[model samples]
Target: MVANDPITGQGANGAAKAAAVHLESILAHGDRPFDRDFQQAVADRVREGARPVVQWTSAMLEPAPEHLLGLLVAAAELPSAADRFANGFDAAADFGQWFPDPEGAADHLASLAPRG
Candidate 1:
């Protein structure tokens, strides 16, 4: 929020743009404004006399992906089949076998439920 002012000779023009960059990037989860770590990084950049890009993130508790990706990788996360498949067909060998969509787990659960 108004971290620098190049016009006023008080802050960096690029810093504002940088801030905007932080705001605009696409997000998954835990990548929003007022996030402790994210906020701290931006503030540190500003404090270091860096430029801002004027970006907006998805949520308050979330963090930037570039920063978060490392943490995710460190956690040894794996992509699911749903993530790999583009559509229903890539999931199975043929129609005879259930090519359950990786993302269709919830649907499978529903199907298994006893219907009246």
Candidate 2:
């Protein structure tokens, strides 16, 4: 998986733009099997300046699978979370077979932050 190029030329707020891009990429690949509500809750927390741990646990209104939840939490806390997720997914032989609904996942992730 090619690492995302650092976001640049966004003027004085380059760091925020880069962070946003990183968050988008991470959420795109990392959110699997979780519902839109969960994804949105995390994205909202991120936009609202919440810590990664807070973002991870913000949207748990009901029971979720423990292992999957742990993955999401860990990914949220890492700086290179998106690259790690993409690499892991690409390395897994059965990943494509297991997740045949990437379009749906992308759509759900997109809904988290609509373009103006």
Local distance difference test, per candidate?
A: 0.36, 0.41
Please state every model's RMSD to the true fold in angstroms: 18.7, 18.6
Predicted candidate 1 versus true structure: per-residue lDDT over 1-116, tens digit per residue: 44432332323444454566565432432545566776667666444433211211111134434423332342343333233222222211221122223234344334444579
lDDT of residue 109 for candidate 2 = 38
Runs in model 1 lying further than 4 Å from the true structure: 1-12, 24-34, 49-116
Tens-digit per-residue lDDT, 12-69, candidate 2: 2324543675577567867466668766765654444422222223223335555445
TM-score of each: 0.23, 0.23
